[model samples]
Target: MPGWEDRARIGWGPGAAPTTTVQVEACPAASAPAAWSVYTGGTWVASPACVPLVIRSEGQQVEVRLAIGAACGENN
Candidate 1:
């Protein structure tokens, strides 16, 4: 924990300029979301809306949840 302070970064707060103006899509995109590493802060990024993808295979229904949006990781 010696270098914790040096490694820490602050994120944007709610209602802040960065947080207040992210326009999310009314409908999520059909494409899958990409994986990003742990945020290092300095910027607000939530876009390319994504939705749950359900796959029905062999009488089994599997839901694939991908965190594409920074808001809650999903459109809904």
Candidate 2:
């Protein structure tokens, strides 16, 4: 393994933010709970808020679990 050097530049271009896929589940009314909320950090808030959910940095990959119920008068 002499004179074997790994040389390469790896990164995104300008205006390119790191992309990652998030897993979200839209439960059916039958399977949805009567009323549920999500446990964010230390406090629990109303699930399925219109605002975007923020995730904490851990490593290259992470998994988040959120329990959301059905909307008012909506099935699934």
Candidate 3:
């Protein structure tokens, strides 16, 4: 079995710092390989790779979830 990496880019609009959540799901057949990424507020906040949940055969599904904290307040 081989390993690979993938990249994803996201963007945000002008406004106060806001919290966001991202979820990625991959379903592949025939012993395939895949990866995922999550971005928030135009920044690459988190990326986890080689999740064990990946199924190499059939009816395999991979799900990635992210919960972002609100940006620090100006008073901080």
Candidate 4:
């Protein structure tokens, strides 16, 4: 299991275009699996990837769903 709280950081680098650069960081654990993707027209797609989920579109908006599972030990 994770700690008392989970954290997420969103930022863009200096000297970079705002829309062109985005950063996401999760605390305790750096990344999680991207559970799904949502686009316009109420469309939903299954997208699975390790996080710091990055979008490269200039002005397109998207909804990303993420699932962070608890950290399990040898106890099962």
Candidate 5:
């Protein structure tokens, strides 16, 4: 599937622009006991990566996939 990931990725919250930086946690809420991510480590992003997040409440959980990547910008 060429665009399978594109179709699978889940996103929400304020629209964000990507940047290659080894800083910023992927999802802060996921770190809490209420939520978690299937993909672990690499809190900071320097390249394209995929993260599957699970949020739980009242014995139920919703799964979402996050796609993080580099944003194009000036070469300089």
Candidate 6:
């Protein structure tokens, strides 16, 4: 199974643009996935399975959300 690093916090707000770099471990297990995505503004952005995401501008401060599940068409 692939292991993921701890989540890194990045402050975001007006005039505050931060970019973070994350490393994704490689795993070749049936239960291990290799890709994920981040959601913002009702849209999904493809991202590394184990990487810190960059946030620019805190819009509405709604909340930072992440969804970890099977890829497009992989049965759980």
The lDDT of each candidate is: 0.37, 0.32, 0.35, 0.33, 0.43, 0.33
Q: Per-residue alpha-carbon lDDT of model 2 for 1-76, expressed as tens digits?
A: 1111122111233433323323334434776767764422222233442222334443444433333332432221
lDDT of 3 by residue, 1-76 (tens): 1121223223344442423322334445546666443333543334532221232335565643332333333332
| Model 1 backbone overlap count | 0
Give the number of the best model, judged by lDDT: 5
lDDT of 1 by residue, 13-71 (tens): 34334322222223334475754433232333233333343545557767654344423
Q: How do these models rank on TM-score, best leading?
A: 5, 1, 4, 2, 3, 6
Over the stretch 3-36, how does candidate 5's per-residue lDDT look in tens digits?
A: 3434233333344333222123356654577665
Model 6 residue 29 lDDT?
Answer: 68
Candidate 3: Cα lDDT at 56: 34
Off by over 4 Å in 5: 1-43, 70-76
| Candidate number with the higher TM-score (3 or 5) | 5
Candidate 4 Cα lDDT to native: 0.33
Better of 3 and 6 by lDDT: 3
Model 4 lDDT tens row, 1-76: 1221134323343443323234433333337664543222211113322223335355675634334343333442
Which candidate number has the best TM-score? 5
Clashing pairs in 6: none
Candidate 2 global lDDT: 0.32
In candidate 5, where is summed lDDT lowest over 10 consecutive residues?
16-25
Cα error, candidate 3, residue 68 (Å): 13
lDDT of 5 at 32: 70
Residues forming the 10-long window of minimal summed lDDT in candidate 2: 1-10
